[model samples]
Target chain A: MKAEDVIRFCGRSLAGYPLRTGLMLLAMAIGVAAVVLLTSLGEGARRYVAGKFTSLGTHLLIVLPGRSETVGGPPPLLGQTPRDLTVDDALALTRSSAVRRVAPLMLGSAPVSLESRSREAIIMGTTADMFEVRNLEMAQGRFLPPGEVGRAEAVCVLGQKLRNELFGNGSPLGAFVRIGQRRFRVIGVLTKKGESLGTDLGEVALIPVASASALFNRASLFRILVQAQSREAIPRAKKAILQIIQERHEGEEDVTVITQDALLATFDRIFKALTLAVGGIAAISLAVAGILIMNVMLIAVSQRTGEIGLLMAIGAPGKQIQRLFLSEAAMLSLVGAAVGLLLALAGHWVLARLFPEFPLSVPIWSPITAVGVALATGLIFGVLPARRASRLDPVVALSRR
Target chain B: MIRLESIERIFQVGDERVFALRQVDLAVRSGEYLSIMGPSGSGKSTMLNILGLLDRPDKGVYQLDGRDATHLTDRQQAEMRRHKIGFIFQFFHLIPRLTAAENVELPLTLAGVDPVARKECVAAALARLGLAERAKHRPDQLSGGQRQRVAIARATIMRPALVLADEPTGNLDRASGTEVIHTIESLNAEGMTVVMVTHDPELGRRARRQVRMLDGRIVSDSGAGHEG
Candidate 1:
């Protein structure tokens, strides 16, 4: 028979039972929609995390006094005792060709009082190069002046929020704010930079490393931040820093050096695997839908035995009979897949609107794979019923009716 | 022309093998109107089914138009049935989902005839059967006689050489049954060979040639000058 005629015949038979047809379509559609929605969520989470890591800075590496066993895991609280990294070590590291700049960091908390407005705020102490290495912007006067390493000049830069709390619409440049029994002159106010790597950048105080070390009564630095001259220099810079730090600490190799690319790559691989896992879980629904199609088609074949016998008697061969039934299944799955795509699109749109901060969008391959799988499932599940229909004895079928 | 030689059909009932047809030999000319008459279980319907290629006898050599058809493959047999034979059933067997016109057009469609020619032929067949007005109505919407007319139109739509009718008027009222019988008689008069199976003795006698069957064997043949 002509292809068009086959489709027309199947269409007539399917239309005879509206409820059954609608139910099959619904099952297939829900299966496809579930796969799409879940995969989108998985893909969105991956993108969101990737964006967060990239914002920290590129071609950057951190040198911590304690070693981190895993690349991305948090530093152990009480691991093997490691040698302290001094400001001298950080300054010496800049001598390497791969290292473009170095910013020594020391963190502590101190109470600040400016005319009875006292707040215990976090204090981040580093040199003027900290602004360039960390991508910080200045809102007011100049940052800490260029000076000798570890010079004890008491100078500070206020975070945007701290500046507002201290001076409230008034300029605080060159004003002295007492921090930990020492007076410090404010030289600059930082432009607002929201949370990054779990630190509220906009609410802290920036001071000289030497002053913070003295106030906290410590000689070793908290960590050292390094920036490579170019992206290609990151590996060399990491090697050079480790060698330099080991040499300075009596060949102890106590510090852990992690590159920004290494951290980002770890996160990328983890999220990619997570996306595939969720997509695989969602595919189980497609299999369930396939089983449903088979069950319903079996019932349809038995119910239409008389009609099938009539066709056989009129000279339609077994292959033609199989094609007719298979075409019906194909039609149902195609329609269901189209509707599922529309549902997924609408779901994505609503999710993007509701959670604007999250990067919510499906990969192009999600819909394509969904369509391919849906068609394959329909054809595969259709075989059993079509074969049974073809094998029925026309004489017996007609006689029974 | 058609020929059947020593045809034997057996049915398994419990542990007993019942012979539905035994050693039956018959030959029919190209344009003959013949009828087979018998009571229930006499195998008249079985004989009609075998002649139409709807069933195969266990031991028989059947020929149609001089072709050795007893060993034809399933597909070859289907092709032969499509081009050379048509069937009309006692129940009419019109697909209830289709309108009268679509039901009549089914055979041509299965033969892959072009839409334009198929439409014209279906229209002509329905008009000839006086079903032009009811062409768009489904089988359920038509009366018993109208449904039978539609079946006849479908059976002859392909212009097959032989038409088989098994109790074609069995389910109709007397007036509708007479109308159906007249329609088949007209087709037969147009030089179409028709083989009908019926239990009505009067209807069986209307054919020019009649064969009577009893318990799996032909007891009498009018063409051979013997009456049971």
Candidate 2:
């Protein structure tokens, strides 16, 4: 028979058993949909984390005072006391040719007042190079001046929200404000950079590192941010920073130098594994769907034995009989896979709308893989039933009522 | 021409081997109307199944139109059946899902006939069987006589050289049975060989020659002179 006629014959048979066909389609659709949606969510999470890290600037490295077992993890607890990283160590790191700029950091909280209004704010102490190293933008005025290392200059920059609270949109350049019993002039107002990596950039107060050390009465630095000259120089910059800091700390590797690429790569590997694991878990359901197809097709074959015998009696070859059953399965899987893709797309759209902050996206290969797997499953599982139908004794089948 | 020599078919019913057909010899010439009559378990249906290649005898040499058909492969046998044989069944065995026209077109379709030729041939066959007006009706919607006419059209659609009817009127009333018998007689009148199996002596007597079977062996043949 012509291919189109065979397809029409199978189509007519399926139409005769609408409820059974609908059930088979539903099972296959759910299988494909599970694979698409689960993998999309996993891929979305990976992109969200990658986006956060990329926001910190390119070819960057962070130097923390204590050592972490891995680049991206928190520092160990209750270990041997590590040598402190100081302002001198930060200054020594800039001598390396691979390093472009460095920002020595100190963190503390203090109350600030302008005239009578007062509010407590997170205080970030860093050098003037922080503006270039961390990609911070200035809305007005200038950043802190490059001066002597221990000169405790009484100048500061304010985040956009902090400036709004302290001066209420009024021009506050050069206006003196009190921070931790020390008065400082506001040199710059930072543009709104939003929240990133748990730090709300719009709400913090920035000051000269020397003044912050005196006000908080501490010489130990929290972290030192370094920028490499180029993408190729990141590893060189990290090695140089470790050597400089280790040499300054009596030849002990007391600090951890984490490159932004290393952190991003670790996160990339973890999320890729997560996506595959979830996809694998969802593929189990597809196998179950395949088994269901087998069961339903077996039942269909037995139920239509008379019809099969009739076709044989009318001179259809055994191969043609098998092809008829297989074509039925292929048709079901194709339609089901199409419906599943549409459902997954609709689900992804709803999720993206519900959570605008997440970078949700379905990878290009997912739909193609889903459709391919569904068709393969249908064909493979359809084998036994089709074989049985083809091997039936025509005389016996015809005699059966 | 048809020939069967020393045909022997056995059925193992648990420990006892029953002989369905034993050392039976028969010959049928072309363009002859013949009937085989027997009681239940007399091997009439078994003989029909073997002749139609639906079953293979344990020991036999059957020839049709001078070709050795006993050992043909499954595919070769199917090809022969597709081109040279047609069957009409007692219950009309029309696929319930298809309309009369589609059922009649089945044999031609399986032979890979083109759509234009298939349509023309199906229309001509249905008209010959007096089913052109009922071509669009499903089997359930047609009366017994009309459904049998549809089956007759399906049987002859491929223009087979030989037609086999197994109790073709067993499920119909007397009037419909007579109508179905007349339809088969008219086809036989066109010089197509007709071999019908029936237990009704009246129906058997309508044929030009008759063969009687007792148990698994043929007891008598009235038309041995017509053998090719």
Candidate 3:
């Protein structure tokens, strides 16, 4: 038979039983939709994390005290220990030409009070360079004064939430707030910002690194934030900081330096694998849909035995009969894929509206792969039924009721 | 032209070989109108099936239009059937989903005839069968006589040289059966060979050549003496 005639015949056959065709299409559509929605979710999570990392400032490096790697050698008999990372070490990192600025962090929790209203807040002590390194924006007043790194300034900046709790929409700039037996003038109030890298910047207080060292009674710094002069300078700045820290600590190389690109790349790899795994799991539904197609097509063959016999008697080749049935399957799969894509798109729109902050998006290749697999499964599963129809004895088939 | 030499067809019924046709030899010249008449289970339908290429004879040298059809490949047989043979059935096996015109167009469609030519041929065929007004009606909507006429139109749509009818009037009423038989007679009169299988003695007598079979063997043939 001609190709168009075969297609028209199969289309008419499928359209003859609307309920059966509809249910089959539904099964295939759900299979494809599940793949798209689940993969989009995994991809959305990946992008969300990547976005958070990007917001931490480009060409950045973080230095933490203590070596993160394990050494295989035995301990020295003299009891050698890794020294602490201090403000001096943080300052020494600025000597390199590739290093743009550095912020040495000191963290502590203390109660601040103004006229009997008291709230315990996390206090982060850093220098004025922290305003640029951490990408902080001031809602009012200026940031910490740029001066000596060790200068114990009696002024501090309050986070948005902390300022609201301490002052309650009143002007908090220049107001003295007592903290840990010391009074400091509020130099600035931070703008509203969300969590980044597990830290809620909206709820902490900022102070001079020297004053936090005195108040907490610890010389060890928490972390050092290093901003490279350019994107290409990140590795150079990291090497210089590690070398400088090693020299200051008697060549121990105790500090761990992490570049933003390396961290981002690690996260990117993890999420891509996660998306693929979830997508693979979702593909199982498509296999089930394929099986459903096979079952339905088998039933269709038996149901139309008389028609098949008639065609055979009218000189339709077995191969032509097979082509007719296979094209029916292909048409079903194509329409089902289209419906599934629409369902996935609608689902994505709803989810994006529900969670606007998440970078929810379907991976570009997912739809193409889902549709390809669907078509492949349909054709593969269609083979048995088409073969069965072709192999039927026309005499016996025509005799059937 | 059609020839079958010593055709033998056997059926296995619960492990016992039963002969449907035994040593059945028959020859039909072009444009002949012949009918095989027998009781049920006498292999009349089997004879018709073998003639139509729907069944393969176990032992026979069947030739059609000077070609050895008995040993042809399945594809070659299908091609031969498409170009040279047509079939009519007792049940009026018109595809119910199709209109009467599409039913008549089936043979040409299967032959890969293009739509414009197919439509023209179908219109002419249906019109020749006196079914022009009923072309748009489905099989269920048409009466018994009209349905059989549609099947006749379908059978001759490819203009085959030979037509096989398996009890074509078995399922119709008397008037419809007479009308269908007349349509087959007219086609035979136009120089197309017609072979029909029927149990009705009255219907069997209308053909120019008559064949009677008993127990898978031909018992009598009116035209055998003249051919010999």
Pairs with steric clashes in candidate 1 = none
Tens-digit lDDT track of model 3 for B1-228: 988899999999998999999999888999999999999999999998888888899998899998899998778878888889889999988999999999888888888889999999999998899999999999999998899899999989988999999889989999889999999999999999999999999999999999999889999998887662
Put the candidates in DockQ order, highest first: 1, 3, 2
Question: What TM value does model 2 have?
Answer: 0.90
Tens digit of per-residue lDDT, candidate 2, span A1-401: 88878888888888889899898888999999999999999999999999888778778899998877545656557676888888989999999999999899999999988999997998988898888888888998888788786889999899899999989968999899999799999999989877778988888889889999999999888999999999999989999999998889888788999999999999999999999899889888777888999999999998888888878888887898999999998988888898888888889899989998888888887778888999999999999999999999989888875
Q: List the residue pairs that clash in candidate 3.
A: none
Per model, how much of the real contact set is kept? 0.56, 0.53, 0.58
Superposed model 3: Cα runs more than 4 Å off: A76-82, A112-119, A138-141, A161-191
Q: Residue A339, candidate 3: how far off, in angstroms?
A: 1.2
CA deviation > 4 Å runs, candidate 1: A70-80, A108-123, A135-195, A200-220, B224-228
lDDT of the candidates, in the order given? 0.87, 0.89, 0.91
Report, for all candidates in order, the number of backbone clashes: 0, 0, 0
Model 2 lDDT tens row, B1-228: 889999999999999999999999999999889999999999999999988888899998999889988998878878878888888888788888899999999888877889899999988988888888998999999999999889888888887889999999999999989999999999999988999999999999999989999899999999976557
